[model samples]
Target: MKIAVFTWNLQVYNHKKAVLSKHVVEHIMRALFGHAATGMPFIGTLLEIKAPRRKDTRPYSEESIEKIVKALQDEFQSHEFKIIPRIKAIDCGGLPNTREWILVIYSGFSDVSIESLGFRKKIAHLIKAENLKAILKAGQRTYRPRQTYHTHGLADIMPNKNHFEKMDTFRIDLKKDPMKTAKEASRQSKLLHQGDAFDEDGDLPLLKQFRGETTGIYTSDGSDYSLNIEAIKKRGTKIANQDENWYRDGCLIKAKAVDSKGEYRISVVSIHLPGPNHTARDGNILNTFKVVGFRSNPDILIGDLNTHTEVIRELYRDLSTELSTGTTLKFNSAIDFGKTKYDRAILRTTSIWKHHSIAITAAEEISSRPGKIQPIRYERVSDHGMLTVVLHDGGS
Candidate 1:
């Protein structure tokens, strides 16, 4: 069995404490518990940590980074975990954010290397997630100009009837970027479909219905709805958790992975909203939480929420009680307060999953363990520190 865990602190800052956090390090170990339950052979695993770009004296002393990594190696003491440290790498883009911070915690299975088996594919997807900043930036350029929101009366429900009839066949040009196509659609003033759901707020926000069609990028008027369906479609489809209070026009997404043998597994969308302070009036942060609450099915949600980890705990508790699925994402927040490195994920199955204690480890501490540590450092990773967790289950 194999699993990869990661966390990033986008804007938050501190020196030694930032490099590693007890909250995050332990989380990675617990998250892996699930894989271990599968009884798979133990292979060497890589613990990759990256710090965000900062100018002043480095956020953390190299010694601090090294100490944390060493502590982890000593703590596990088991051959099962091959604790690595200080894995640094170059970045094509400068840094993550202006605040200058972000960290990565990647723990691979003990037996597999990047070159062997299906590890490459898994690592590739993770790398893509790591590079979401680029993807979002690209989306902004392609979607902003053409974006619009509309509401429709019952009569307008059939606006696209004429267009649909004229075209009996639907063809999506893979070569042409779909985002570009959606942008063009956004720019059109002419009504393509009647009862435009996006223009204004209705009983059901338009973005919610169209979430599956798009991926999860959106830009809408604060009151009504706005979602980037094109991006959602390409990345994965997700729906929001079904909480009545947050039953607005939003969505949650799930990821589907297919193996070479034609086998597949599904995962829920993991998301983190910017600080509520940054976008409070629109209630974007609260809306995001409510959406997660309302979404149904199996999922794992994670991100730098800009809210306290305690809030995440409360939401999970409410969701568990309301949905009757005793499940939650646990975090350890001892070092820093306020926003935590919100790294989390979910499995969409209907069964309750098991968990273990969680921790947060430093990047440099990992480096001191020379033979096993290989920290991949990058600049401007993000503001919030990286977050990760390990899970344990017998595999249902």
Candidate 2:
């Protein structure tokens, strides 16, 4: 059996007026699965999909997972498809908008089960736990008390009442008081553990809670656990100043497929990592593997990694999976930036699949004028090209 898995950053969030038109949705559906003339089953890992809100009306209404699925169903005319929409509410630098999502759309598979492992959330929890532990440890440290004048005799010895006022103005340092500091740290850690540290109104909202449309084991609760003060400041600074969100996450899909020889189980992961910060991206990749567990590797891992550094490359290499080559990004005339590949798919050599081939779409152009080829105006679809990895079962 040969399965086609594709990863694309749909860029719906970047759309003009942040609206994805019906025609654009249909174009995406056709461009991705329509070209599979070989009748091979397809699994599409689409990223940066903007979820529709009730406040959005008219032209903005069609930009949703439901609309995308409807377009796919209309294009394929088959009822054998399943969609796993992992809606993640992003914190856009304390901004009101939190609408981006990731989607895993599959077709022509009967025994397929997709799930959100919550590995990323678990990683956040672990990091928070460690941070709180450190704070608690710091709070337990003994500190020498600063010398202070006895207030009873200080006023009599003072040159004027102004000196007394100045002495009274000195604030008591929390570090000098271990008991108070410990109690405060304990209270904050408890609030964090109980998910009460965050302001109720400021919490990121999850779409699954209201829509009830997601079909997976895990629907994100939109709880952020990266509570380290410095980490929060770094992320906040980048989000506010650089206009980029550093929150990253992914999901797992398990399916059983049959070939000429026998049936085999396949594991696929759809991932999206932080884009602007390389350090965060690297840590995210490392924690992603930890979330996935180091014991077993997924058969296929696909998504936008924003891979521009060798650290990311080496991390994937250490995982025994090689990222598919070729430029996956399209030229941006708005930014005057040339093409570069950041989106990719990894097919594990240790997996059941024996052979593989990759194809990149939505990044090239055909000439309307005779013999006058031109670059694709990819802004119609996305900033990143669609990457499809075809894995063979090595059976005749």
Candidate 3:
């Protein structure tokens, strides 16, 4: 089976977002998945959906989600691509937090299955009830009781909370004076934690919390099966993933499917660590995967890791295996300021059916379908082209 995991940062700003989203879906479907006529492709997102803004600045509620999704479903159902969304948690942005960036898996290829892992009890509940695993978090950060696990979401149940062990990192500015930096860092941290202000430099804790947010996993809905999910709780700074560039979550999910065919275990990890300054953190994250058993097991790592060619070369410098990063860029990252390779991937110990490195030019075409009510011309959506890694295995 040829599978393509493409990453697109559709920074859509249309008020009629549903219409634009439909276009995005079709565009991506054609761009990454072998051909539009090919079987429905499975798409996973480490992306965000900006909500329709209002003066009140309220978080996205269930009603808003229902209407928006219904529209998308009505549009997608005809194409045989069902939107199986597991809403992990509503990311209430601070001040201008105008978007909800949950991880979502859009699969319509076949009888695909969905599962929720991590400390996302509310997300799990919704998954069970709606039969959709959400792109959500294990727990929400709160200051009321200052506890790890707490009640969140509209649901009554309290979500489970898991913490990342503080890791060792060489990226911290050892060049700076420690006494002065600590005093500054400590004061900034205290202010940010207290909500006294929203200075950018004082956001380390928030960044850490965001990077370690809860994420989910899924499989094709084939045959009756039972599932078991494991989360690698212990992490280190040296072999961990983080970035100061943007605020988002890191995902590492392990899933097993057992049915008549056989039993198969596959781990999927999505990363958003930026670089070249964060090289130590990025390397540590990869090494952490090795330490946590992802090295030996069949696994697929994807998302916007913000790596350049030299960095990629460095990452694979001493590798003893032929396992390759799935997508090769058609453009140079140095000139494009690394965005050319913003969304790169690495796959090892896994079976890949195909790999398509696609960079759609400034190409435009009119959609023939009346579904595109407007005389809509398709366009390249994001600045960074999609690097799709189609990786899977023959069942055990």
Candidate 4:
């Protein structure tokens, strides 16, 4: 038995503003799964799909889900598959109208069960735990006024004094000046407590806040001096927020397939990690593994990790087999930035399937010239190249 799995990141927000036409949808489906003539059973993990809604700025409605399902069904008229769509909304401050979602479509399976790990809730918990540590560290510090620089004009210069008067203007060295550092830390603690560091819902703020203060000193000879203090304040280290970045909550799907010989269980996790913050992305991936439990790793882990770094590779090296689908992202895309290999799939080494091969499909030629290839639909449909994996059961 062989099953083909496909993973793609549909750039819904940037591609057609989340409004996909039926033709475009059909084009994408055909490119990934091939025509019904092939008669291949497969599973697809689609990320960043914008659900249809009445308004552009409204959260996806139930009507939208129905419409998406209808679109899938219309495309795969001959295939019998289950469409599992999960809404991954942005709710950091308040619910925004972001309609990004993850859809897992699978067929040729006897039974399938999907589970929502509450990925966002896990992200919140991780952030809050780090914030508490930051607060504790801030509590031990004191607040000190920043250094001031004073300059006097000719009128203020005494007759006996030199024509020029200079005061120490160098920036305060927080490392050398423990007092000042402690003071700054105390101020940070206060700001964090005042809800300035975190959002209304207690989640870490996505944007940094600016704070400035000025203190004036009176000098004899009718002269005055002032110190202008400024600081870029944030409660703790910045983490990834689904609302602010091109991120959507991921889910785990499990299925049972029956063959002539017997039945086998298949587990797959579809995910899209935050791209801006590397530290946050790494932490989230590790946290996801924890949530999924290392004791029972999924058979297939597929999605856009937003990066292809050594750290990420090392994390999965021992647990799974990786497919090197070169440059799974489209060229000249906004997020491309010279970095490729964003989308990927990994199969557990202990899975029942023994062999696999990969194919890159949906290459849309932006230019009539040769070698000017882009992902099918590119900006119009998606910015990611479609990747398909065929898993073999190693039996006749």
The prediction achieving the highest lDDT against the true structure is 4
Model 2, range 219-247, lDDT digits (tens) per residue?
Answer: 11111112233443434422111111223
CA lDDT of 229 in candidate 4?
A: 29
Per-model TM-score versus the true fold: 0.31, 0.56, 0.47, 0.59
Best by TM-score: 4
How does model 3 fare in lDDT? 0.36
Mark the regions of model 1 whose C-alpha exceeds 4 Å error after superposition.
Answer: 1-5, 10-266, 292-296, 309-352, 365-383, 394-396
Q: lDDT of each model, Cα atoms only? A: 0.31, 0.45, 0.36, 0.47
- Per-residue accuracy of model 3 over 285-366 as CA lDDT, tens digit each: 3333333323333355565555444223222221112223322222422112222344545555334222333342211232
Q: Give candidate 3's root-mean-square deviation (CA, Å).
A: 15.9
Model 2 quality (TM-score): 0.56
Predictions: Cα RMSD each: 17.2, 13.8, 15.9, 12.9
Candidate 2 lDDT at 197 equals 16
Residue pairs whose backbone atoms clash in candidate 4: 142-182, 142-183, 143-183, 144-183
Candidates 1 and 4 compared: the better one by lDDT is: 4
Tens-digit per-residue lDDT, 126-163, candidate 1? 22222222233234222222223334343222223343
Q: Give per-candidate clash totals.
A: 105, 1, 23, 4
